[model samples]
Every structure is written in C-alpha cells, then in structure tokens.
Target chain A: MEGDAAGIMDKSINVLIVDDYRTMLRIIRNLLKQLEFENVEEATDGREALAKLRAGNFGLVISDWNMQPMTGLDLLKEVRADPRLKATPFIMVTAESKTENVIAAKQAGVSNYIVKPFNAETLREKIEKVLAHA
Target chain B: MPDGLRGRGASAAAAPPPPPSAEAIEAAVRAVLGSLEGDLTAKEAALLAELEALGRTVRRVKAEIAALGVEDITASHIPSATDELDAVVEHTAAATNEILDCCETLERLEPQLGGEGQAALRGAITRIYEACSFQDITGQRIAKVVAALKAIEARVAAVVGTVARVAPAADAGGAAASPAEAAAGARPPPTEGQALAQGPQLPGAGVSQDEIDRLLASFD
Candidate 1:
C-alpha cells in the first residue's frame, strides 16, 4: 500500500490532526509516525484547526468529531466552502459513528471516517482512500 | 325600673299589647343569614381565583420545561459526554494492551537476540513506553469531562428549582426544599431512549463498522 497511490502515502507529506484530547492527538501522531508519515501537526479543536488550515499547506486534514464552539463537521463545512481549501482531503476520526453523524459528514464532503480505537492498518487504509479519492 | 320608666310603663305596655309578629322575627333571622352567606360566597370566590392563578403558573412551568428539553438534555447530551469518556477508557485499555504485547514480544526476543538486536529492541520498548503516556493525557481529558458533567448537573438542578417554584402554598414547605429532593421525588425513570445514556457502546452494541461502510457506500 505504500507505493499504491503514486506515493500519496509519502512519509514527508504534512498531515494535520485535530482533537480536543491530547492523548488522542499523540496517539494519532504516533500511529502516523509508525506508518512512516512524520510531518504531522496538531490542533485542539475546530476553531484552532481552521486557523491552522488557513496558515498551512497540509496535504491531509484528520479531525475528531465532537468539540467545543465548533465541531469537525463545522470545520469541514468551512473548509469546503473556501475555494482555496475545498479540494483538500479531509478525514473524520471520532468515537462517535452514529448513522446521523456519518450521514452528516458524508453530506459535508468528508473524505473518510475512522472510529476511535483503530489501528495503524486502519489509519493507513483510511488515508489511502482519502488521498486516492482526492 | 327608673321612676320615669315606671310612669311611662302603662302607655308602653298599651302599645306593646300588639305583640311582635312571628313573620317579623322570621324575616330578621333570614336577613342575618343572607348577609353571612354573601360574605362566605365572596371569600370562596377569592380562594377559587387564587387557585386558578396557581394552576396557570404550573401549566406555564410545565410548558417551559418541555421547551427546555430537560429530559433530552439529561438523557442524551449528558450521556453523550459520558460516552466520550467511555471511549477514552476503551482507548486507554487498547493502548495498555498494545504495550503489554510489545513487552511480551521483547521478552521472547531478548533471549535470542545479540548486542545490536538488543539495542534495537530497547529503542522499540522505549517508544512503546512513550506511547503509553497517553494515560496521563487521558487523565487530563477525563478531568475536563468531569467538569462538564458537573456543569450539566448544576443545570439540571436549576431546572428542578424551576419546576419546584410552581408548587402551591400548601406544598411550599416540601417543594422549596433543595433540588436533590425535588429530583428524587419527581425525576422520571430512565426510558429506553436513555439506555444509550450510560456510556460509549461496545462494537457490537453500537453501529458496526460494516454498517458504517455500507452507509458510506450509499453516499458514493
């Protein structure tokens, strides 16, 4: 899967992981590192994620669903609405996988969904799917 | 009798000789009762009016509570936060389990490995140790969640007070008690809808990954 998507899974590609939980952010960062993808950044919530998204040229945006003041869904909408960021591949990583939540994310143009307690392989598959689709 | 009354007594007696009529006495008695009845009726009407106002206030409070969706907030929103905490617990467990697996792997390999291999395994073990630090961060996140639950509990207590304030004067003593008393007496039992309110569900208990994939495929 490493060379499958024209090196879309390239280790140096920058990825932004947004989560309110520091543990979750570190866990994800470690998993990405395990996958040989090290150029990772972090944000605490959707508000910070939006600011970071504006400032950085990230290849992938991975965010958690539940957050204060703004949710990942809201961030997705903001990103999609912006012409500059509209084409950016976005993935939702959350513990909540309710049907309504999934449907909403899909409608808002989420690239993929990864439930919590996932493994490195699952993360790899989700990233590959998102990048390939984009 | 006085001397002046004694002098007039025969004349007074002559006039009084036409004895007081029974009909006149009956009429006086009737007049007294009528006045008393009027007063009683007015008092009853005032009491009834007060009761009606109380009823209206109670109904308004009920409507306000329904509008606030207190049940849903307690049943759904608070529990959702709880579910996130549950997920955190599960994630913590998984992280610990992975670390254990790494330890076992290293233990088995330590006996067979040479010097450089031992160093490589040590580095791997160190990384696992660092990853396990998630528990500390999870602890911080749990504290935040506990704070949030406390806020929700306070809000629920406030709502209880709102409902209790509508109690009639007769029940004022009992109703004006603390929110806990009000909740203990009036809170509805957790409904079927509230079953999910306990915590983040297990894989089989919640929407399965296969189901999620199917739903995702639908969007495509």
Candidate 2:
C-alpha cells in the first residue's frame, strides 16, 4: 500500500488549485510544490476554474468553497455533471467547516475535504488519500 | 293662627300659580344651551393648542434627525471602515507572500547545507508556511466584517431616505445623491450561495476537523 501511494504521488499529474484570494492560491501552490507536485495551475474563481478544467487535463482539483461568480460547490456540481470531468479527484480546501458544507461537498462527489488553517501535512495526507483512491 | 295651623291656612290662602309661561321656559332652555356652548368653545380651544404642541414636537424630532448627519455616516464613515479593512487584508496578504518567498529561498539553499542544518531549515520553513496561513484566515474574517458594514450602511441609508421624504427641504444643499439612491446604486444583489459561504468561524464556533472526518466516514 505504501509503495502504491508512493507510486501515485510520484506521477507527474497536473493539478489545478482554485481560490479567489491570490495569497491563498500562492500558498496552496507552494504547499503542493513542497509535496513535489510541481505541475500545479490556478484559477481565481469557479468560473475561470471551470474554464481551465475544461481546457486542461488536470488529474486533481483543490478548491476554496466561497468565491464570487461561482462557488466551489457549484464548480464541483458542474464537474460531476460533466462526463469527461466526472472522475477527476476533487479535494475541497476551505474555511467553511460547517457540517452542511461537508455534507454538500460529499453529495456533490468530492474526493476529500480539508478545513482551512491546515498545515502541509494535512494537505499531503488528503492528497495521498484522494489519489490513492483514484 | 297657631304656627302649624297658621302655615296650613297660609298655604291654602295662596292662589294657585299659572303653569310656567312659554316665555320663561324658552329663557331657561336658552340659558342651559348657552352654558353648553361656552364649554364646547373652551374645549375646542384647548384641543387646538394641544395639536399645535404636537406639531412642534414632530418638527423638533425631524430637526434632530437631520442634525445627526445620517448621510455622512452611510456615505463616508461606513465606506471608510470597509476600505480600511480591505487595506488590512491586502497588506497582510502581501506580507505573507513575502514571508513565503523567503521560506522558498531558504528551502532552495537547504540542499547545500549539512544534514542537520538541512533538517532544521526544513522544519523552520514548514512552521513559517503554517504561520503564514494567518493571512488567509484574517482576510476572510475581515471580509465578513466589511460585508457587515455594508449591510449597516444600507440600513442607515434607508432611514435617511424615509427622513428625506418626510421633510424634503432637510436636504436643501442637494450636495450629493440622496442616500437611498446611493445605497440602491452601491448595494450588489446578494448571490444565492452567499449565506452558506460564511468565512472563517470564530474559535469554538464551527465544526472541528475531527468532526468533519467522522462525518465523511459516516457517508462511506
């Protein structure tokens, strides 16, 4: 299992991170870099994120829940509804820790959820768990 | 006559009076009517005086409301508060990024150091990264405050609108657009999901990570 996780993590998978806050986007990107996932891309809001998701072949998506124009939940629903993007591993990284938010994300077919103020280890764990399933 | 007998005799001797004359009845009725008319006139005068006093009170209240400068609060002070909060978010974000940049630089230099030094550098970098998350949390909290300020500003502007309608001349200067107009123009229609997108919760306010994990597990 460890070997399998390692093999999955070692792959050069394209990752897309969505956040309205530029600093948050940079922070997530840096965290992904720390985990050696260098092929990371970003979009500021869900609409732009959807566009990027359609244009690119990203293996994973880490998104913030609250954003203008379109929210992360809306993006997840759109992704799930799209046949091509339905199977993409999605992880929600948000400040919204409400139970309803978690339930909504799960129902929308999210692979995992990470509450905000989380460290790199938590991010790593979530990514590994999500990709392992993938 | 003896006292009782004489009184009885005197009553018997008195001639029977004719029924009250029509003229006398008319005079008596007129006097009662006059008294009632006088009372009504006094009451009417008192009521008029009371109404005048009430009118004066209402005018005074209107003046007081105008003096409060509700327009300045909504137009100037509330916007300024939001702008300051926005600046706080911006400055913190910039500082956090700078810190992250420094950490990245240090990480890059770690490879050249001895094994112990490299480990120490990695630990410090990780801590810095974690600490820098304060920027995101604080930014979300401040954004929530800004949203609240806007809501308050809207409410104040609505009051101002009502006052302006009640006393149109109160805003004689016409220096700025009516507060109601400004609020209507400035306020964005709330998005559907805004209520659910509550920013960072205060400590002990929202669900914990462990609880979230357990909930997900239940879904499985």
Candidate 3:
C-alpha cells in the first residue's frame, strides 16, 4: 500500500498553479513544496496560465476560479476544447463551493475540487486522487 | 349742397341701420375663436418643450452620476478590494499556522539532531514564532480597510437611492446594480465566468470539503 501510494504520487511532476493573489500563490507553492512537488510554476491569472499551458508540458494544473480577463472555468473549457490539453489532470482550488459552481466545474471535466482554508493534507489528498486517476 | 355731403347726410338719416348681417357676425366670431385657438396651441407647445427639457436634464444628471463611476467603485473596486483584504487575512492566518507547524516539526526533530543543529533549529523556530506577529498586525490593518470600504459602500448606496428616488425613470436601466440586486432581474445577466466565479465564501457559507468529495463521487 505504501509503495502504491508512492507510485501514485510522483513528486517530480510539474505543477502549474493559477491565482490572482500573490500570497495565495506563495502559500500553495509552499504547500506543494512541503508535499515534495518541487517543480511548481505560478500564473497570476487564467490568461497567463493558458499561455503557459500552451507553451509547456505541465502534468497537473491547480487553479483558482476567480480572475480578471479569464476565469479558471473558461481556462478549463479552453483546455477541454483543445485535444492536446484535454487529457491533463486539473484540480480546482477555490472558495466557490456553491452547488451550481460545483456542478458546472464537474461538467467542465474538473478532476477534483478543494475549498479554501484547506490544509496541506487536503491538498495532498486531492492531488493524490487526481494523479491516481490520471 | 355738394353731392358727397348730401349722400352722407342721406345715409345718416337712413332709419335705424339693420342689425349686422349674419355673415358679418359669423366672420367676427370665427376671428375671435381662431385667435384663442392659436394662443392655446402656442401655450401647449411651450409647455411640452419645457417638459422635454426637464426630461433631458434628468437624463443628463443620471449620466453624470454614472460618469462619477460610483457603480464601478461599488460594484468592482470595493468588492475586489475587500476580497483582497479578506485574502490577506486568510493567507496570514494560514501562514501563521504553517509556521507553527514547522516549529513543531523542528521540535520533534530536535532529539534526532546534534547539539549545534538542535540549537539552530530551536532558534529558527523562535524567529518563526516572532514572525507570526505579522498576522495580528495585518488583521488589524485589514479590519480598518474593511471599515473604510463599508463606509464608502454605504455612501454610494445612499447616493444611488437618492438618484433612484429623484428620477426613477432615468435610473430604470442605469447603473443601479448594487450587490443586493446582483442576483435579481434588475441587473443584466452575468456571463458564465462571472456567474461561476463567486470569489471566496464566508465561514459556514461554503460547502465542506467532504461534502464536495461526496458530490463529485456521485457524479461518477
């Protein structure tokens, strides 16, 4: 079981985190680092995130829902529309837990959702579940 | 006598002149009615022009109020500012907890380290604890911003209410989309992204993580 857990959680996968808040970016980055995911990148909004996603071969995406110009939901839609990027695992980390939002995100092909004020353990669990399915 | 004087005297002597002809009396009455109608039409046109000018003035006032960007300030700036401040509080509190967690982790590892390493870890933990003081200061400062934003929001709402009352028709389709009516029919429908991006939720307002997990599981 421990070996399986280690196999599922490949620590070297590159992670792209999207948020408009610098502090949140730092916090998530630190938490990812604590989880031994050292290869983490950050984008301030969904537009920059899309650009980066198109430019790089990211293994996972953890994004916030609210941002100017482009939102995470729009980014998700764009990713899903693109055949090449549609298969990448995506986790939405946001404070939007409204049933409609959850249903919308689920329909948009989100792999998992984590509410805000979450700890490292919650993040790890979500990440593990996402990657395991990936 | 001269012929002209003789004719005038003869007409003056004409026995009582017959009452004015019917045609002549009717012409006289028609002239008076025409004058009265013309006066009434002119007055009506003037009154209508005044009313149209008033409507334009009210519209201009509404436009100026919109131009003041009160709607932008209340709808966009204040909400985003408060959200940012709330994020500050959330991040600081999270960071403080993480720092404490690190300190505890270090303490647990102290027994495994040499004397110098243990001392260094202990000192580092102390410094981290000291750094956690920022959370309190930041929270207090955020509270101030929140209070200021509340005051501004209230003032903007009052201005909006006054405008709405003064010229309800003018503001019927204007920038009166306050936060309260954001979900109502008075506001334009939100775009898909705007609808989905509800920002952060208040405590107990959002669903729990476990509930979300269950919800997602049900989707399968």
Interface RMSD of each: 7.0, 1.5, 6.0
**lDDT, candidates in the order shown:** 0.68, 0.80, 0.73
Ranking by TM-score: 2, 3, 1
Q: Chain A alone, TM-score for each of the models?
A: 0.93, 0.95, 0.95
Candidate number achieving the greatest TM-score relative to the actual structure: 2
Q: Is candidate 1 or candidate 2 better by DockQ?
A: 2
Which regions of candidate 2 deviate over 4 angstroms? A1-4, B1-57, B164-192
lDDT of 1 by residue, B153-219 (tens): 6567555444532223313433343444556569655422122122234457556666777889887
Q: Single out the weakest 10-residue window by summed lDDT for candidate 2 chain B.
A: B16-25
lDDT, candidate 3, equals 0.73
- Candidate ordering by DockQ (highest first): 2, 3, 1
Which DockQ values do the candidates obtain, in the order shown? 0.10, 0.44, 0.33
Candidate 3 on A48-117: residue-level lDDT in tens? Answer: 9999999998999999887767888988888888888999999998767787898899999999998765
- Write the candidate numbers in order of decreasing lDDT: 2, 3, 1
Clashing residue pairs in candidate 1 are none
Best by DockQ: 2
